[model samples]
Target: MMRRSLTATPGPARLRISLAAQQNGCASGATEVTSARAAIATAQAGLTAAAAADTAARTRYLAATQAVAGARKTMLRVQRQRPYRSARVAHAKSAVAIVTKTMITRRAQSGKATAALTAARTGLSIATTRLAGATSRWKTTCAAVKVTQQKLTGTAPTAELTARAAAISRDVVTQVRATFTTADATTVYGITVHRSVAFAFQRMIDDAKADGIVLSGGGFRTRQRQIELRKINGCPDISTAPASSCRVPTAIPGRSLHEIGLAVDITSGGKTLTAKSAGFAWLKAHADEYGFANLPSEPWHWSITGS
Candidate 1:
């Protein structure tokens, strides 16, 4: 009689536990997605700020260059006037000497010659001072131009920082793509990508289609499939051959982003994708907004991360 209970308590408990686990998984996915979005936003903001700073520095540098040019012109003009002023000073001093030596009837004439010599010397001194000021201004402006150019291009430390930021952005995108699950796989434009990326790909495809482009591709290969392709493509054994010798630049099994369901090899109406194609051009112009980037070596290859 004790074993006659019809209710299954453990079954309901197990069902509840499973449901909770599923909910937690969904929550974790959402959190990851949100984090990825935040990272993208931060990267975009940094790029914008860098661009603005570069523009400002360029403007300042151009102004400094013009200032230097003006200073040089002023210095040249002063230099030209300096020789004339010196000649006038010499001539005036000779006049004074001549007046003093020849006992001139008018002492007023001697006095006038002496005053003219003093004025000429003063004018030469003023011209020399102006030239020196212009030279100093030109040097200062040249220094300013160097500093601004360094800021615009970046010094060693600034260059390293910029490189690190770029690496971080690429890493974040890679991490997001790596988190994709089997359930996240979806068909897009005759290809497959993670559900998270599928919408973006679809948008890109639709937009391209509107512009008279028809795109197609396959994506999301398994490790075994990748291995098979590698063998068929006459890929050199990665363990023995240098990676550079591979005919197809396919990654080793289990090592490809394509295996993670975030990459695709796209084509336009069965034609090979190339830099010249409209579809490729469209993707180049707009794919980054959708969190996709083209693999530089392979025009047909596009992924969440450039790697």
Candidate 2:
């Protein structure tokens, strides 16, 4: 088919006729198809961009979840080993390191290994500091305990009297009774007196107590032990009771070590030796030199050099 070009004529009637045909026919509308196609292309571009964004967000969320899970697992494993003790920290660190390496190797895409490494390092640093403190405390406590045990084992005055002598003296007085006319009645040390020994023992106790042998409020157990031995062994005071009966009660009617003055009570309390009395302190430090050993149960009691 051949197409013809239409030309405008200079006549009002012809222009009117052309306008009427254009309004009545579809051939006159030509640009609407092109505009519709352009709109469809723009909508497709927007949809593609939105889908890509959603995919990226999903990937990021998944990665974060994996990282958190790895961190929690690592923490649980480390905590299980009890890292509070210094001796165990090395093991904890090694365990954390191994777990971190494994996480990195197995989950390469999530950066799990890097996160695990950071957590492990932080945990190890804190654990090391705490462990050091705990170790130091343990050592200090052990040392204190050892010293206390040794002190308990050292000899005191109660080791001196024979069983028979002790029984006889105990029957007389049951315990030593002493009073200082010038000062308070205080305990001194333990001596082996039984109304039968020689004058030498009582002299030692007299000299020690008169010279202020007991320290005020020293070791209580050691002092008390000494006192019990003195009482049971018939220790002396400045009283006028016969020296022979000093170690034995006056009621026993037999010659006691106190009569010979060979035993003395030097304890003030149980498990303690006082520092306030020079005599008591001297006994604690020098009693061994005189062949005297402290009794664990009674700090004040002592046996003779050979007995």
Candidate 3:
């Protein structure tokens, strides 16, 4: 046998069978590789989607943290302002109280000072009134004495006139002494006086008695009798010792005229006499010649010569 033909030629049917088997195997392998590639792509797409979701969540957390921090800062600022506002209110209240207290104290002091000033003014007014009245009487008696003295200038004292004057003094004293018998008159009236003033009172009483002018009630038989005499003689209104003494207490012991002499408070022709007197007015015109003068209040009071 020829060396056997190792390369055998396939008939047409066997070749067809070989080609069919080869095509079937190739199609199966292609299908498996495509399925694996598709699976890989799907896994990659899933990983990308999960990463994107994680990034979005992180961004939102950062924004929320910033908002919280902003809110905390605003709260701290409000807290800081609270104490300052309270302090301001307290200071305002204290200032108002201090001003109110000061105003009240000043008002009280002003009221007290005003009251004291008013009282001082009242005392001064009373003292002024007393001094003015005393000065008015003194001028009147002096005028009457001057006129009386002029009338007597050319004529000397007649024995009858001297007798009459002496009797007048005696009569006046007799009447006045009876009224003065009470304890108060003796204590206040005769406690202090000049010796000459006492002599004048005695002489006047003696003179009035001699003239038959009896002074039953302290140099007045009646007020009406004295008034008639005053009208006839053109005599002025007369006040007596209680109204006419010097208000000031005597500086010298027993020096006041009112204390010893009967105070003859008289005016001339219904008016006070001047220091210069008209003629024939014994209490005014001849008072000095007979040792008499105008007492401070009682214008008609006289003293003895050289008293």
Q: Candidate 3 lDDT, tens digit per residue, 12-112? A: 23433443343344334434445545544554454455445445544544454454455455445554665557555555555545544554554454444
Ranking, TM-score, top scorer first:
1, 3, 2
Q: Assess every candidate by TM-score.
A: 0.43, 0.21, 0.26
lDDT of candidate model 2 versus the reference: 0.40
Q: Which candidate has the top score in TM-score?
A: 1
lDDT, each prediction: 0.60, 0.40, 0.39
**Measured by TM-score, how close is model 2 to the native structure?**
0.21
CA displacement after TM-score superposition, residue 194 of candidate 2 (Å): 99
Q: Which runs of model 1 end up more than 4 angstroms from their true locations?
A: 1-180, 238-243
Pairwise lDDT winner, candidates 2 and 3: 2
Any idea what lDDT model 3 has?
Answer: 0.39
Q: Give me the runs in candidate 2 sitting further than 4 Å from their true place.
A: 1-29, 85-307
Residue 62 displacement (Å), model 2: 1.1
- Report the error of model 3 at residue 42, Å: 99
* Clash totals, every prediction: 0, 68, 43
Q: Which ten residues in a row have the lowest lDDT in candidate 3?
A: 1-10
